[model samples]
Target chain A: MSADFATCYPLKRGRAHEVCGPGATYFAATCCNFSDKPVLWVCPSWQQEMLNPEGFAAYCDPARLLLARAASQIDLLAVSEEALRSGTVGLVVTEIFEPLSLTHGRRLQLAAEAGRTTGLILMPEGMGSNATETRWRCTPLAAGGDSTLQCWELIKNKSGTFTDWVTRWDAAARRIIVVSKTGERPRVARTAG
Target chain B: MRARPVDAPFALTAKESNTDRIQCLNTRAERAGLSRGMTLSDARALRPDLITRPADTPGDAGFLRVLARWAGRYCPWVGLEDADGLVLDVTGSTHLFGGETGLIADMRVRLMRAGLETRIGLGDSRGAAWALAHFGEGVAPPQQPLQALAELPVAALRLDPKLGIGLERLGLRSIADLTATPRAPLARRFGNGLLLRLDQALGTQPEPVVPLADPPQYGVRLTLPDPIGLLEDVTAGTARLLAQLCDKLKTRNQGARVLQLTLRRVDQGSQQVELRLARPMNDPVSILPLFERGLSGVEAGYGIDQLRLSATRVEDLAPTQIASAIRQSQTEDVAALITRIGTRIGLENVQRMLPADSHIPERSFILAAAAFSEAAPNWPPRRARPLRLFPPEPVAGAGPVPPVRFRWRRMALRVAAQSGPERLAPEWWLEDENWRRGLRDYWRVETAQGRRLWMFHTPQQPGWYVQGEFA
Candidate 1:
């Protein structure tokens, strides 16, 4: 009767520190490019240029669909900003990981409360954010063996509590097991009082 | 040669004894004991020297059969009737060889020079001609056997001894007697067997004569007047035959995929040479040269008198209409070129590698025919691969980072520059040799001069080997 927290919070205590924040729900969108955040790569780098947010949302190429189908923890989207504004998705994972204004955060908080599907925005390295449920970070780890994969992580949960954990990733089985345990921290409100 | 008995010239006369003295004897001499060759007195004493020369009956028959084949050229329905006569049905084609009489004279003149004596008989039926040829005295008027054979003796009918005896016993020795008798009385007395033969000889009955069919389908057969001994001559003969056969195929709107050449030697044996084409083609020039290479290795012992070229497998000749803008170089028809090469070298020699669903490089490709080139596209997308791949080479290190030095073959090299622990798990569903050994973590390690190698360390086997290297 409880939701799958592991699937919902795959970036907890990981190198994806800026995206995961202190909140009951979160949303983010990670694409091949972080600089062009709202502009999801609907086509390959060789295709026509990005027109507008609506135009980009309509672009559904096979390669993007293939990647979308592979996503285990979250549902992939073409327009994360629209999903957040319309309260369609609980969490909008955007490629943009910049600090949001109070107004933007309020809109996202309202949308996340409305939709059940939380969005996790995948940001590139060195990107930071001010408003999020958690700021968990992730990096490719050394492979344990032929079948086992390790990913470096940092978890920033809803309580604004931070911890580090080495998660073993089984790509074949699509399961992530925690290897090195980190300190447990108290939960905190993500939105400003 | 000088002495012989007056009654019996010779006790035994072989085929060619001294016959000069016997020839000097007067005419109307008895053949007494002159067997074959005998002295004059010996032959005369026995009985007398009989006039004898040589028996050329068989030689005469052979000559007549040749003339029959020549006559067959006109009507194509000519058969030698016994040893001395030919029966030709000039019904439809008599005008081609002139009229019936002209044709007969022409045949006779040709036979005369070939050292043969003959008689001419023309009739509406074979039996009439046969009877007239034997007993008509001179060139008889063309007649139906019933009328022209009236005066001819029973012997002239060429009836077997049993039938002749039966007729003679009945006092109906001549055909005339048989004709006068009523059909019912004849049937009741002697049965109707005699009537059947009479009707057959008169062309009133249907007798099925089986003709030999040309054995292979797409064949061209050539018969030379004189046997050829030279290889060049044989080659030329083969070329002519191939050309003719190709023409036949072209009109049929088909092309040959395989060809078989039969060289019939004069010594009663034949040689068959076959060649396969990668693609179907009917052009003799393209196919002839292909087989000529194969013929070079054949031992044409004495000589060849006949050459036959036949197409074994044929395909519909769909002439491809190339767009005018498309390049019209010789290389445009790759199938034709491949076929030519395949013919000269061997079809098995031209092979292509096709991709299968396997991570293992060795297991990835399956050898296929060059004709199946369409099955394979540019393979192995640009990924760093080894120049060669052995089984996984054993590595000492167990942790994440690859071993600095590992033994491959007998040579050991320190890792100069390495990338990747790209893990490719063996498909468990597929029973693979590598799967039984466990999974592999592949690494692209480069030696000196960008000599990149793909090395995999088996987790189960706990070893590694160079799998492949990129070019």
Candidate 2:
């Protein structure tokens, strides 16, 4: 845990990254805010929870998102790979239930690199998947009242040193306000309603 | 030969009067001594190894219709003859295949090659053709319909079954026998059907062939000099056909939405690959690659001798004169990607969330099929909504308030920080379909596990329910 990777606020483009833990969707949705082109969000059909435009709009423009409900985990990966390889969309976030193999992860990495599109593989809190470029975990942190805090842990990085950041989601401002960084004293967010 | 070596008897059965009877039988089944009307059980008992399948009546009719369309390669005016036959009016079109005899031979060879044991007849009129094909010699002397029909059984004239039996009882079993007897008596007994049928067969009365409607067929076909079985060759053939078809579509100011590619093999049956586009496209460069993936699913089986591309769905695409800037290319790129992905998974599965003028979280947005819906200008500034919404699952909490700690999806979550009891009431018209009852108190709860879940409590239902996650 070093402060050297502090400026890695936006993940690298044209590569695949793994994001897990409770706030993974938050990180994935925020990734859409970094680019101007369309965003592709692919998930398996059985995952009944859908992106609410109201919540999604707080982080990324809901209009810029193209949601694909793939019939299965295999199709989920397939469609995300196709979307990434097409280079049309600025970003592709694939949500999966099962762990992807290292080879499949490598294939997706290559597809993203070939198309120069950013790809994020989103999974549930404990699910392990091959990390192609960077791996980050998001956990909801305790706060006293009326506001939410999150810890984004950059546990693995290929281009920079490992670092984690604490952030508060300011829904009204529709932005993520960084609260603290690695090795810093944690402080409560000024987000009381 | 593929169906049980072409030696073992096989029959197609249809249920009639609560029992399965043979509707059609192959020559092998006929040689094995099973008749068309025999009960399937009796046939199976007699020939224990006989194979039978329930005949699909509608499917058979569809197959016949396809054949009638295929028959257009020979004659333009082809009409359907019930579910089992095709009446092709090859009157002036016979010269294309050389002569009448050559045409008949050619048709017989092609039909037999396709494994269809067809019965074809040539005559001066429709009645003579039907009668000669069903009863007399397969061919008639030119302009000699009377000579050909004279020996046919009375049933061959398409007579009423009762009248045919009455004619049989009077020893007038043959058409000549009925004609020899005075027409006045036959007409009086048969209600003019006998003489009318006789005149039609004799070419004295004109019988028009009601041709099938040629619906603006945007189709192009390629007949290869030699059959090709490889996937690459099929793809190449598709490209050629696509260009030709796109040209046809362009002249009419239309674009193809659904395209069907049919590949007829050298030895076996044909395979069809259908591609449905997200938008109407008349350009071959854009449409050709869509066929690439679909064509791979086709098993060439033997070499493919013919490829036909036709558009089943077309939309009016008035010529675009605009040379759009950078935005159009990007929009077109996204649309192209949508089409590619949509074609694989269903087009309905790929969607764009369009904002709606509603306060209800679910009603605030609509998922429109990405291919069909225009992209709305990026979302307008709006109220905060949960990232993911769930169908309200009951939280195991007691009161009409956000619990200090609650269990959801079998996980114990301790609520550390929480936001409002934002009051939202059910629309009067939507009360019955409301997700929760009465005024809903909505809360944004942050769990000790770093979960940001959106929960609500119904005042009337007296229960706390988790509906979405913000993370």
Best of the candidates, lDDT: 2
lDDT of 1 by residue, B343-419 (tens): 54355433444546676555665545554344232454424343233454454555555677765556565666677
Q: How far off is residue B99 in model 2, in Å?
A: 32
Task: Give one digit per residue, the lDDT tens place, for model 2 in A1-193.
Answer: 2244345657788899989987888888877876788999998867768878777776777778898999887899889999999999999999988878887888899999999999999986555455578888888777766455778888778887777777777767766678755345443433331
B115-145: candidate 2 lDDT, tens digit per residue: 8887888898888899877776477777877
* Candidate 1 segments exceeding 4 Å error: A1-193, B1-216, B322-337, B340-345, B357-359, B372-382, B387-401, B448-450
Instruction: State residue A188's C-alpha deviation in candidate 2, in Å.
Output: 21
In candidate 2 chain A, what residue range of length 10 has the lowest lDDT sum?
A: A184-193
Cα DockQ of the candidate 2 complex: 0.47
lDDT of 1 at B317: 63
lDDT of 2: 0.82
TM-score for all predictions?
0.37, 0.64
- Deviation from native of the Cα of residue A168 in model 2, angstroms: 3.2
